[model samples]
Target: MDKRKKTSQMQERAMKTMPLGVNSNGRYWGKKVTPYFQRGKGAYVWDVDGNQYIDYRLAFGPVILGYAYDEVDEKVISAIRDGVTPGITSQLELEAAEKIVELCPATEKVRLVNGGSDATQHALRVARAYTGKEKIIKFEGGYHGSYDYVLFSTYAPPSTYGNSRSPITVPASSGIPSALGDLIITLPFNNLEILEATLKRCGNEVAAIITEPMLGNFGCADPLPGFMDGVRRLCDEYGIVWILDEVKTGFRIAKGGAQEKYGYQPDITTYAKALGNGYPVAAYGGKAKIMDIVGQGVTQGGTYAGNAVAAAAAKATLEIMSTQNVHGYIDAMGSRLQNGLRAIFKKAGIPCLLSSMPAIFSVSFGIESNLDAREWAKADASIYKKIAARAFEKGILIDEDPREPFCMSYSHTEKDIDDTLEIFDEIVRTL
Candidate 1:
């Protein structure tokens, strides 16, 4: 293993100035700090200490096309040379929005935003304004963003929450106002009976039901069959708006995201992460009837929203994906990795379940029974974390915490998958 002297020095300096020595909480691995990345290209990243690794984290699921892709970088450079941000909207903004409208089925009208958190917060405001209701329903183990409204019940301990049929709303972070918990109703994911029962009692007071089409917070779990259909049906029955939070699943799962993959249309949809590849760009839009109220009664504006550089990057990224069929390449690489890992686990006689789609995957150790987030808590996650640390020492990078998934981009090649699988085999044998 390469010594991380330089990385440790940087962390020591940063800890004196920055809170937790990182900008985002996810960057920390318990008491241990993650390595600082100096540069990235294709499917590889180099640390400040000059150690190279085959990356599967993919910048927390944003580098869909890969790191520093030439085509997108060229477009962004040209846009930056002309101007980064103008007092008024540029032509690039219109072009980027048009691309999103064409690809995503639910977005009849779209508004550019700064990040995933910005899109989710605005979507909730629009929903509340449209239906004139005060409360919202969110599922347990689903992460929309860092905002206070949706932070309830994400990554919470099983003891803090209620039973499987019913769930109690618990704050995921500190310093959030306690009263905000009263406005949110948390329910178990993939359970339609509990959702229907709760909605029947509080349907009139609920403004909307916001959910990630897939549970990205807890290891890339797919939705149970008919769960999404039930959500759509119940929202229509009541007057509650349906907000599909596609922050993690958008643009990576399919051309139109989870909505296209599952054949369910939402009243409001939030887009981010893979939308701009690695750039800072996000959007929230849906049926024209709902978004029309954005400027009229609800306000969603940001200075960095629709900046020239990000707009050009997003436009180029979407065009390349459309013409080149990037999803096809991603699927091939993902399949190779998944199949190879499964074979390794079986040969080593380890109890493992690989939960994922073609773009994202996660490894669960010693889980035999089908489980929701509650039952999953009984499993020893430290086992997976130990394996992840061992893999990192062997020139491979996956999230130490198993909750975050391993994301494959179009840029990942067959060679990278082969090398990763070889390392994975060696690592699992040690366990």
Candidate 2:
């Protein structure tokens, strides 16, 4: 009778030890609806109560191939058999780095890290070190990592965003020192004019202009035409290190990530997520001239940086991506799902805008365009929340927050797309 009975019990028990009964803040979807997953395989996951659902969250976009992919897992298992972390480098690390250099266009060299946050934090530091500057520029709603330097204007209330010309740098967290905000500048996404003006004013003091190719965190709001190229030109003109934070887009958008897809080269690029197909591996590197500063008095190292397990996972994942049609399959499936959803919304007479690529996109209701986080905040997400919650009840799983995009993987099938559409249609009609 009570499907979530076990889950509720687990939450109550977990809260005694862990804050909010979850390790990550995003995982706490309130005690009532938070799910405790048991295992995942392919495009589906089973909860502790043994309820099955077609998973679209994809562990926040890291499970690119699929959950428990045999090819990746087998490699990781074999590597673990040998050892995990020996606190030193191995041949596997070299192979993984080589594969990255071969595939990603912007990367001439790379330094492995533990996660997206590590990659981004180090990338910023490297930019500052290389340029001999103190200040950095980031776009509003562009989430780089959990570090203090980047924890501004992300998830902050739109009312606090101030004017578009001179936006307030609202800190995302409280513990961040107010003095840090002075060194950082936050601007709206998709607006190159503001970026150019800001850079012209303080370009010499700015070390890097770090941005996601698209707003990955706030409903995948895409760059306007020539936006990426404009950023490159301005960065070159101002002598600013362009750090493309592609933790979400890398290995998922294309074989060469955003650099290949958009044809705009960045001075430095940070990658995670699909790089290891859900394993804890990430990297930051770019032009040899910029990245070579890492060892020569510019410190960048980690205890588990090049662990064998993560390296093997990255090597296997990239090798499979190179040999197989991973992106092709994911694109096809994603397009099918996107088309089906568009048709459903059209038939329902509801205003909706889908932003970004087929593989990673967002469905925003009652919003014509999403150029930046401020515009995206105007979307009537309550309808989306209702649809997502009801769909979850009917064996579909998606993030309730509309800002988070729906991620597709190679494992999602045509049948899965059709089934999802059917369920969405049913729910939309009721709404």
Candidate 3:
């Protein structure tokens, strides 16, 4: 096993000042994974103890091109040296917004923000302002962000999530006002009937229906055929705003994202994660008429919203994505990894289901149909967690939480896939 002694020491020291010894709850995820990363490049990360890992976590799906990618980093550095977060907006902000609008068909106008959570919050606020409504509908296990309004039913325990047709609006975090839960409605994902029924009954009260085009936080669950179309139809019929929270799927899935892949257009789209290739940047925008309210009637402001450095990084990342066939490489590599893992599991006589898009995927052990979040919750997660632990021991890195998908980047190669499969083969044989 790789020695994490130095990492452990740092963790001890960090916990004195920082909660859970990490800056973000995601790093620890209420569980312990000992090695701390010092640096990363291409498809690999080196821990503080100098052990290398083939990174499948990819900083929880943000490092699109790679960690510390030269072009993006150079642009960010240049912008910083020139002066970051200037008192006024810079050309970089417009350049970044233009690039995003050019690529994402759903975004006619765009406004920058600091992170995914903020982007989603802004999108919902705009929706409410536009529709003059108070309630919003979110799918169970579809995590938009940590904000109180969208935090309900995300990561809910099965006991709390009452039933499929009408799920209880269970709070994922405490200190969120109990009254906010009443404003938010929770529904089962991938079910058109319940969604249609809910809209028919409470469509007048709902300001928006926000969803991850493909379920990202629970499993990489794709929308069933016509599911997205149905959503669009219902939104149009009810004058309800549709908000696609593409924080995990944007740029990484395709140049145009899930709206392009699934053939449905949302009124508002929230983007982050892959946009700046690990830099903290986000945006929320949609129809020009709706986005007009952002500055005029509704307020959306942040001290670091359109900082030059992040805008430069996003512009550079988008430029690279526009010119190159990044998705082709990601798709090929992800397919290889998925197919290889399937073969390994088959050879080991273990029943498993693999769900994937080109860029993100998940495996549910002992379950052949991982159709929805509830289905994902029913899988033998302990087995995947064990495999993840074994893979970590063998220098392969994936998050132990099975809910997190394996995020493939443009940096991953055939060799990385092969090496990962070899590790999986070894791990499965022992099981």
TM-score of 1: 0.98
Over the stretch 1-431, how does candidate 1's per-residue lDDT look in tens digits? 53888888888887899887889988876433478889999888999998899999988899999899999999999999998889699999999999999999888999999999999899999999999998999887888889898899997886789776667889998988999998999988788898899988889999999988767878666678898889999999999899999988899989888888778799999999899899999999899999999889678788889998779988999999889979888988898999999899999998888886879877887786433676566666988888899998888989988877889998898999999999989888788
lDDT of 2: 0.93
Give lDDT per model, in order. 0.87, 0.93, 0.88
Please say which candidate is ahead in TM-score: 2 or 3.
Answer: 2
Query: Cα deviation in Å at residue 239, candidate 1?
Result: 1.0
Name the better of 1 and 3 by lDDT: 3
Q: Candidate 2: minimum summed lDDT over ten consecutive residues — where?
A: 23-32
- Model 2, residue pairs in steric clash: none
lDDT of 3 by residue, 265-308 (tens): 89999999999999999998899999998877798999999898
Per-prediction TM-score: 0.98, 0.99, 0.98
Off by over 4 Å in 2: none
Give the best candidate by TM-score: 2
For each of the candidates, the C-alpha root-mean-square deviation to the true structure, in angstroms, is: 1.3, 0.7, 1.3
Superior candidate under lDDT, 2 versus 3: 2
Largest lDDT belongs to which candidate? 2
lDDT of 2 by residue, 1-431 (tens): 99888999999999999999999988888877999989999999999989999999998999999999999999999999998989878999999999999999889999899999999999999999999998999998999999898899998977798999999999999799999999999999989899999987999999999989889989899999999889999989988999999999999999789998878699999999999989999998899999988999998989999899889999999999999999999999999999999999999999999999988999999999999999999999899999999998999999988899899999999999999999999999999
Q: What's the true lDDT of residue 429 in model 3? A: 90
